[model samples]
Target: MSAFSRFTPLIRALPSTVPFVGPEAIERQRNLPVKARIGANESGFGPAPSVLAAIRARAGETWKYNDPENHDLKQALAVHLGIRADNIAIGEGIDSLLGLIVRLVIDPGSVVVTSFGAYPTFNFHANGFGCRLATVPYAGDREDLNALLDAVKREDATLVYFANPDNPMGSWWEADDIVAFTRALPETCLMILDEAYCETGPASAMPSMQALIEQPNVIRTRTFSKAYGLAGSRVGYAIGTPGTVQAFDKIRHHFGMNRIGMVAAQAALADQAYLHAVVGKIKKARERIAAIAADNGLLALPSATNFVAIDCGGDGVRARAVVDGLMQHGVFIRMPGVAPLNRCIRISVGPEHDLDLLAEALPQVLKAL
Candidate 1:
């Protein structure tokens, strides 16, 4: 039957695509069960017991719509970050907030800058908004800050997306360098510093909140997904100047925060002890993943995120074979999508049992190749 033909030109012009093909989708498409689910950078360590309890306590209250203001979460985050509540804006996750930021700043034909193979979701959002993309290739397997800055200037771009402890390749820059990059950007260009993995990275890798919190042009996006083990909750917040963050209220989905998710995030925030413990576990898991790569003679790149990107020592074709071969054994993992970077396969930190599956499958996969 024919579909309605009233969609906007931008919507009609964009191709239907998702930034990442999730593991569940892989299972359905390939008809294989995932034994070790470590591909999407999710924390397999799980949320704190206290957070689970909080969700249970509030599950009965699910009928109630969440506070549109997101009052308690904002207050808790403000106290936790030593910033004012007004300086924060909560969203479903960094992904939703990125789309909102793009909507706020980008118009048709506006220019948006990002790393060539960085987070693809930002690019998806920019394309949905009909903005032109200006990409900078990775330098030393890391996002090239100098080139990104140059691109913004050259294109007169309105928006730029950058991630610290970046995904896929899992590379990062020191906090000082990041601070310098922020200061160096054109005031007219809004910078989204996606710090979703900040808690798992080295302290030296994160800029002091005070350093960028007041910059109107800079918005640091963080999530409860990584270190807090709350990816399912979809709770994320943006930090920026009060005036800048206030703009979200004008366009944001009022009442978008889930009640139980808010409760879990609050409970997670209150239980910093559990957070510290999980971080230690994550560090150990990262080491185990790297050791597994070394055992097979592949090089595991240094990572500040929860995942390790192991260089398969070949092109994208070889890396893809390892990914598919591992999946045949029910050990699911992922690899970068672009060249040079695509030579590496990305694995998220999971419990020892999952790594055991990986360790067993990886050698066999490489041997077959």
Candidate 2:
């Protein structure tokens, strides 16, 4: 069959790719059931019981389109964060908001800055908008803030993406350092501080909301996908000055948020007791994952996130072998995409039984290698 001839140049130039393959895709491709769903940085601990109850109560309202303004969710998030509702903009998730931000600021050939091996989705969105990327390499397994700032200045970049309690490698910087970085950036460059893993990290790792909430150039993105155990809900928000966040209203999907997700996020926020409890469990699970890595004679890097990145004691080839071997045993996990970072296989925290599967399979995989 012949393809449609009419298409945008940007669409034609872009290559098809999967930034992060889901476990379901792996199952279909490899024909293996995933015994431990510990990849993709999803919370195996699951959402709070109250959140599920809220979903059930609101399921009947599914026929109605969600409020285009996202009124209630924004109000709830504002109260939760101690900020005005005007300071917030809700989206499907951080990923959706990233796309919107890129669309708002980037034109063809606009320069964007990000860590060389940071979150790929942000990179994907930048490319989709025809922005040129200026990638700064990781310094000692962590995103180098100084280098990132330097690149933004050098390239005269319009946008920059940075994640705190970073993913894949699970490294993080102190909140004070982050505040300094944000202040150091030129006002012309818009900074997206992706705090997707903040809840799982230490108190010291997260900046005070008041510190950067007033900065027009800074937008801090947060999600219910991590410690809140609501990855399926796809609810995330951006915090910035009112004038700054108002830009989203101009280009955002007016009714993109799911009704059920809004209800779940509201309930999830109200039940802080449950959130605190789950955070404790996440911390414990991180420790267990670290222990398993130690038992298998691999070094588990310090993580402020829900997952641990275990150094497999060799290069990307060796790390990949372990990943493939573990998947062969139905214990699914992932690894970093670039060098140095790729020497470590990333594992998400799950219940004891899932870790039990990992504990059983890891040594066997290593022995075979």
Best by lDDT: 1
Residues 110-189, candidate 2: write the lDDT tens digits.
99999988999998999999999999999989999999999999999999999998987799999999999999999999
For model 2, the local distance difference test gives 0.93
Runs in model 2 deviating more than 4 A are none
Candidate 1 per-residue lDDT, tens place, 267-300, comes to 9999999999999999999999999999999999
The local distance difference test score of each candidate is 0.94, 0.93
CA displacement after TM-score superposition, residue 304 of candidate 2 (Å): 0.5
**Candidate 2: which pairs clash?**
none
TM accuracy, model 2 = 0.99
TM-score of 1: 0.99
Please give the clash total of every predicted structure, in order.
Answer: 0, 0
Q: Which regions of candidate 1 are displaced past 4 Å?
A: none
